[model samples]
Target: MTCKSSTTPVMGIHLHDIHSMASKLETLTKNQQLDQNDIKSILIVIDLNPEPMSIDDELESSKLTRKEFAKSIKKLAELKLIDWDFNW
Candidate 1:
């Protein structure tokens, strides 16, 4: 995303920009209508710097409750939409 706005950071990106991108990703990840929050959560887990993301980390990184996150992850896995290994 090339921003011509004066508020744009000279280098790197603003944290708010990342959140905005995630919001956009909610509707842009697929052609079909899927659970937006679930998709966003999965993207967060996958986009993070390191592999083997922990359950606790996912909970902490997201606004979702443990149960909610687990449910989404499980659903995505069952649909074969995602298959990354994370710490339990």
Candidate 2:
């Protein structure tokens, strides 16, 4: 159950170099160019996906509280980074 990477799991696939991904995400946020809704939605996908992350795990890896993480996911979903249906 160890992903050994930082990118959130998707469809049981663990993206490599999670740290870099996170950095890019941070940059996106800093630029204020990313859609807030999209951020929330992406967080939602990460939260609801079948990955084995606990709230504590998320805190440890993503430095976000459970509530904050949930909120962020909602934003991502709105942006369409993640779909509600399991199509992709």
lDDT of 2 by residue, 1-88 (tens): 1221123533332222233344456577678866755344334223234448643654666555555544443444443454433222
The runs of at least 3 residues in candidate 2 whose Cα sits more than 4 Å from the true structure, single-residue gaps closed, are 1-53, 84-88
How much is the lDDT of residue 20 in candidate 2?
Answer: 36
lDDT of 2 at 69: 46
Q: Tens digits of per-residue lDDT for model 1 on 1-80?
A: 12121222233333233344444444554545556464433332233333475435644665556555445445444544
Q: Give me the displacement of residue 82 in model 2, in angstroms.
A: 0.7
**TM-score attained by model 2:** 0.35
Off by over 4 Å in 1: 1-61
TM-score of each: 0.34, 0.35
Considering every candidate listed, which one attains the maximal TM-score?
A: 2
The CA lDDT at 17 in model 2 is 26
Per-candidate Cα lDDT values, in order, are 0.42, 0.42
